[model samples]
Every structure is written in C-alpha cells, then in structure tokens.
Target: MRRRGGARRAPAAKEGGGAPSRPPAPPQREKLAVSTPFFAVIGLGAFSAWRGMFSLDTVRVLNAYAFLIAAPAMVLRVMSREPVAALWNGLFFAAMALLGVAVLACGILLFRRLAGLPFPTAVSRSQCLVGGNFTFLGVPLMLAFMGDRAAAPIVIALIVDTALIVPLSIGLIEAGRGGGSPWRIGLRLVRGTLVNPFMLSILGGLALSLSGLVLPEPVDRFLLFLGSSAAPVGIFALGIAAFLWARSGDLQWRIVMPLVAGKLILHPLLTWFVLAVLLRLDPLWVQAGVLYAAVPIAANVFIISERFETGSRPIAVAIVISTALAALTYPFAIWAISG
Candidate 1:
C-alpha cells in the first residue's frame, strides 16, 4: 500500500514540478497578434496580384487613388493637427539626410573603382542605396504602428528627402552624363520639389496649422474619411507592384545585392546610430527616422536610372527585392524599437 501511495504521489509531483506548458502561449499569441496587421496588408496586396483579382489597369487606378487622393488627404489632416514646432526637427533631419548622402557618395565611388562599373551605372546604383519608398511604404507603416499623431517626424523626413536628397541624386546622375549645366540641374530640382503633390500637401497643411484656424467640421470629417483609405490601399497596391516587378526576370546580382543591402540594412543602422545614440533625439522621432531609413528602394530610382539611360534593370531588381524583404524586416524593426 505504501509503495502504491508513493508511486501515485511521485506522478503528481512530476506533473507539478514540470514547467507550465501554457504560459508560453500568450507571448507567442501576442507576437502573432502584433504581426498579423502587417501580414494582412501584404497578403491583401498578394491577393490582388493573383489572376482575376487585379489587372494592370486596376493597380494603376489604386495607385492613383492612394497617391492623388488618399495620401494627400491623410497628410493634410495629420499635418494640420500637429503643431508646427513638432514638425521642425532641422538638426536631426539635416544630420540624417547628409549622412545618407555621404554614405551613398562613398558607395558610388567605391563601386565605380572596385566594381569597375560605368559612371552612369554607379550613379544609378548609388541612388538606389540612398532613396527609399518612404511615401507609400513608410508613411502607411508609420501611421499603422505609431498612430497619426506620431507622424510628424516622418513628414519632416519626407520633406528633407524631397528638398535635399533628391537634388543630390539628380545632380549626380546629370554629372555622370556630363550633360546638364549645374544651374539647369538646380532649377530642375527646385521645380521638381515644388511641383510634387506630397510636398504641396505638406506645405499647405503646415500653413493651415500655423494659421491657427480650425477646419470646419464637414471638411475635417471628409478629410478624415479620405485619409483613412490611404494605408490599406497604398499597401495593397505596393504588394501588387512588388509581385509584378519580381517576375521581371534575372537580376544583376553584383549590383543588386550591394544596393539592396545598403538601402535595407546599412542606411537604417547608420540612421539609428546618428539619431538614437549621437543626437539622442526623441525616442519616437528616432524610431520614425530609422523606420523610414529601412524602407525598400523607391520605384523612382528606376525612373531616374531610365532617364539617365543606365542601370535601370539593376535598380528595378533592387526595388523588387528590397520591397519583398521589407515585409519581414519591417516587423522586426517595429518590435526592436517598440521594445
């Protein structure tokens, strides 16, 4: 009887002494919960790319809606509500932009010499390293994870990119061609920045914010409704775009790898160091800056490369790879910074 009783108690003790199997489930569940939204957006895009769901015309229409209507409305609403003071992070913006340019300049020179790339190819590839899909990918992702109120830094970064980095990219491309005069390039830069809908929306919003006048209830509500559509539409369109580009045949691995690495990894790492460690910026601002830095190469890089007649294929491949990979990297970035 004693032996039987001891055996019974031993089994109970073993059960009690073992780690609880249920405790780990919640954390895992929470992680999945956090990641679900991101994947849902990507999945939506992927679904749209499937046959019968979205055609090329459908993608174009969705992109136009997001760019011309939804995004601007969202930007206007957010910027109008945010204080003008919060939008002016000149030091941090300048530091981050200048650092990005410097890094890309070095990359251009290094690839030119070491890789023996032609000047136009080097310039195009370097632009891929520096530019990011901040508007479509970064903006929506920022609004999703950080909320609309936390988007001022991202807007500031967008302005800085348009104002400064873009000119540098164009200048480099033109210089490589030995074609456009410096004055002509400078004028084109100014025109391009001024004419950009994104920039215009930001400026208009800032003006409204600074004016201290509240938007009427109807207008405000309308803007809110329109702005709400930007994220889902933009992300879905991005997914379709990625799917189309990825099927565009073999990549120039030599050029694509370095440019993709620089855009997705090196730029964000350097931005984090400069903003988070050196400047000790607001934690929110640092996260936004780093997140923006980590976005995939912009599609415009291909446009620029094409205009200059160099490295367009490599740029397109880099954009496709970086955008696809960002689906994984973005979640990790949010987790790291949020934690």
Candidate 2:
C-alpha cells in the first residue's frame, strides 16, 4: 500500500525529534520581565524620596512638567499618528464604559450602606476607588511593557475615564454636596472638561488626524522628545507622592485596606471577566483593559476629595497602598488575561 503512505509522513514531532518546542515560558513571567524596568524607575523615585531628595516644591515642579508638557506632547504625538479608525473600537469602548459605571455605582452604594458614610462622602470615596491613575501610572507602565501597540488603547481608556467617568463622578459629588443647581454644576464640569490639558491634547490630535495634516518633521521630533520624558517623570512623581503619604501618619488601615482591595483586586477581576471571558476582544485590548483597571487610585481623586471637603486622607492612603501592592497584582492580572 505504498509502504503505508510512507509511514504517515513520520509524525512531525518524531521526524525532527526537535524536543517538543518547549512551550515558550509562561506569559506572566515574560510580562513580569517586561515590566521590571518600569517598576525600577518607580522604585528609584521612591528611594530618592526616602532619601529626602525631593522637596514638596520639587515634586510640584515634576508634576507640572509631566502634566503640562510631557503628557500632552506624548498624547498629541501618539494620537496624531493613530488611524482615525482606531478610535472607534466599539466593543472596547462599551466594555470600559460599562465597567466604569458599574463599578462607580456599586462602590457608591456599598460604601454608603456598609460604611454608613454620608452621601457626599460616599460619592467621593467611590470616585477614589474607581478613578485610576491611568494618566500617569497606567500610560507609563503600558508604554514601557507593551510597546507602541499600547498607545491608541491607552488613549481610548484615558478618554473614557477622563471625559466620562471622572466628570460623572465629580458631578455626583458636587450634587451630593448640594451645590448650586444640577444644571450649573454640569455646565461647569463640561467647560472644565473641555479646557483640561488631556482633553485639549486629545481633541487637537483628533482634529489633526481628521484633517489629514502631518506635523513638520522637526515639530514631530520635538513632541516625541518631550513625550518620552512623560513616562519617567510622571511615575517618578508618583513614587515621591507615595513616599510622602506613607510618612503622613494618616493611613487608617480599616479604610485603606478595603479601598486597596477594591482597586487592585476587585476592579481588575471584573475587567478581565468582561473583556477577556465575555467579550473576548483582542489580546492587546484585553491586556490594556485589565492593566488600567488594576492601576492605583488617581491623585485627582484626592484633589476631588479635598475640593469637596470629603476625606482626602483616606483617598491618599488608598493611593499609596494600592500602588505598592500593584507590583504583585499587575503581573498576575497580565498572566490571567493572557492565559
């Protein structure tokens, strides 16, 4: 019978005896490796803070650089190059918006009932728990670990969090405080959102992309240079901020522990379930969603807490503890999503 069809082509594995192809190291391990440098820079910042290398004024200057210059430049550069089509990842956007709203609502209700917090305080606490530091911590970590594929998704998530979740949460807090009228509060939020640096950069970039206009080579290079500084500087400032918070003697374990659990564990678990298990979006988007979800509470949350005369102390503690714990949780999140 033709020698039994040449022995079934000699089983490919036996044919070469090439040692089972060694199932390429667990993805989590690879992901952890990729994130090492980013974490190291952050650690360096913390170490510097511990050493008293950064004054409050110095930290403020660093924050200004990252927020006003580096971050906007980076966003502008990245958004300008992205295909207009990349902005319309409908499933990703829906998934993010759903997650944000669900988490915010549930968090508010839970904190209000379980903690017996006042309505305004409950709203502020919920905002702190859900509003991740995607602008500084998430963007830098993603760019460092995922490379260029991270740019567009990061921007999309930022938009959702910045334009939608943040403004909504803040508006609720303001309303709970019995602010002027609901309409006036909303109008103020709208105007402020429009003028925000992050929003401005996103709008400008989209406008450029829509117009099909390319920046001059030198101008583009300038943006690239400025944007490159954003990652390190922003993360470094965060490190210092964490250091300061830890020394403040304001961290109530009762409050900080629960908030940390919510942000570092609960939020990411929900995101993975929705994006990876349910929707089954592209792996990059899934990774992006999970990573951002796992990020620590935003510094802006503390600002919001202070502005509303809610408890900024608890918010600050949550930021420090959650970020510290993220070194472990983030890699696991990556592994879970990838696997």
Candidate 3:
C-alpha cells in the first residue's frame, strides 16, 4: 500500500543524451513569416509593374474592378453582417479622422507659410498630409495582420476619410483656387460622398444591418466570392500604380521629405494618441486607426489636383516617395501595434 502511493517517474533520456531536448528554440520566433503573405503580394505587384504585366490601361481597369466590384462587395459583406452596435464605432472613426486631419492640416499650413508655398500648392500639400491610401494599402495590410474581422473597423475608417476628410480637402483646395459658395461646396461634398460606390455599399450594408435582414444564402455566397478577390487585386494594383508614379519624374527632396515624414510618422502618432490614449477605444480599433493613418497618401490626391487644375507634380512625388518608404515604415508600424 505505501509503495503504490509513490509518484510516477519520468522517462529516462537516451544513452547519448546529455540533457533533455529544449523544444527546438521555440521555432526561431518566425519574425518575417507572419508578414510573408503581405510582402509577397507587394513583391508580386512590384514585379508586375517592372515587367509590364499590366499596361496603364489594364491597370486602370483592374483598379476599377477592385474598387467598384470587389471592394464594395467586401464592405457590404462585412458591414451587413456587423451588429448595429458595432456600426456606432463610425462616429468615433469620424472623430479620430477629423482630429488627425486637423492636426496635420495645421502643421501643413504652418510649414507652407514658412516655406512660402502658393495657396493652391499649400492646399494640395495639406491634403496629401491628411489623405491616406486606406482602401488600397490599409485594407490589405489590416486583413493580412488581423484577418477578416478587421474589415469592420477598416470600412468605418474608410468612410470617415472618404466622406469627411476628402471633401474637406477638396473644399479647401477649391476655396484656395478662387471663390465658391459654401452651400455649393457643402452640397457637392454630400452628393459626392453619397454617390460613391464604396460609401453607397457601406450605407446599404448599414441599412441591412439596422433593418435586421439577413442576406439570402446565394447573395451571401456571391458577395463572399467577390470580396475574396479584393485584397490581392487591390494590392497588386497599388504596386503597379506606385511604380508608375515613382517613374513619373525626378524627386523633389524639399517637399517630399516633409510629406513622407508627416504621413508615415506624425499622422499615425497623433491618431494613436487620440484613439488609444484619449478616447480609450478598443485596442483593435486603435490599431486599425493608426495603421490607416500610416499608409501613404491616397492616389486621390493627384486626381483631385488634376481635377482642380492645381499642383500635381509635388503631389505625385509625395505619393511615390511615401509609398516606397512605407514598405519599410509599415512593417515598423505593425510591430509597434503588435507590441
């Protein structure tokens, strides 16, 4: 009876073993493996661009498909499935976006005055400081890091940037150009936001969510199929566009250096402070906000400049440099958020 109470002994090591094996060094931490898919997509895009896998016209078509078809489907799928309570986060997203824009806009204004930039140039540059590549770069990166659950916060942030920040930038640029009635500008902003395919999809999704209507099985499956294509296609398109923009012309160090620094560093820091420290949002939300802030300036900056017939060269240079540098800065941003 006493012998039966003894504890079981561990298995003996092999004769040649000096000590028990130490679990393979915990798999070497897999530092780069986590980011492998993201960087792979980016590398493919770069190669595509360098090899001319897609022409300019073909690239535009691909972008349109991603934006209008694939991306909107993903947005709708996520938003429609999200609870109405989750949708309330849009207000916080809008607030954070507005705060980031205001902070950066002020900095840009001060820099513009000190540098003696023209009004149109100043406005365009300020827009670049605030606007981000949320859909193209931000969405894919977040999906890569956080998976499908990230879509909700990302979509909300996209809405805020597209609806509020974008219009404000456009209005400022328009105001700088000449005179326009405030009412007209406001109306245009509203109409533009409402009419956007991306925004419209989000609204439809919200409406469905609020209405408590479940998507039919066929519809749901269709959306999932389309949504699945958004990340790869959008990232590839971004790479191609970035390559073309970088080759557009010679870099202007004076303007580009500041723009890149502000976008990749200052914007994210301010966003993190506002969302994580001040508002105390969910960690995921804070991370999503900061990540969106850290992306390069949206391609819309150049389009808006062209539309308004304002400064385009500087904006293009800023986009190219910021995007290229982001290949480095984004990884750091991810690590910061993860840590």
Task: Judging by TM-score, tell me the better candidate of 1 and 2.
Answer: 2
TM-score of 3: 0.83
Cα lDDT computed for each candidate against the true fold = 0.73, 0.78, 0.73
lDDT of 3 by residue, 1-339 (tens): 011124322221222223322233212234324445654676687688889777667668888898889988987887777555545555466667677568657965776779887776677777777788877677766766655456567667877777777777787777776658888877887888888988988888888867767788899999999988987787777677767777776788887788778888888998888877876766667767778888888778887887887768778878878877777787778778767
How many pairs of residues collide in each model?
0, 0, 0
- What residue pairs are clashing in model 2? none
Clashes of 3: 0
TM-score of 1: 0.83
Deviation of model 3 at 196, angstroms: 0.6
> Model 2 compared with the native: what TM-score?
0.88
lDDT of 2 by residue, 1-339 (tens): 011112211111211124222234445667777666656677888899999989667777898899888999988987776556554566788889988998989989998899999888888888766789888778877776666557667778878988998899888888888888988998999998998889999998888767667778898899999998987898888888778878884869998798888888888889888987887666667778888898878878877788888888888888888877777777777666667
User: Quick one: best TM-score, which candidate?
Assistant: 2
Look at candidate 3 and tell me the lDDT of residue 289: 78
Please identify which of the two predictions, 2 or 3, would achieve the higher lDDT against the true structure: 2
Q: After superposition, how far is residue 63 of candidate 3 from its true place, in Å?
A: 1.8
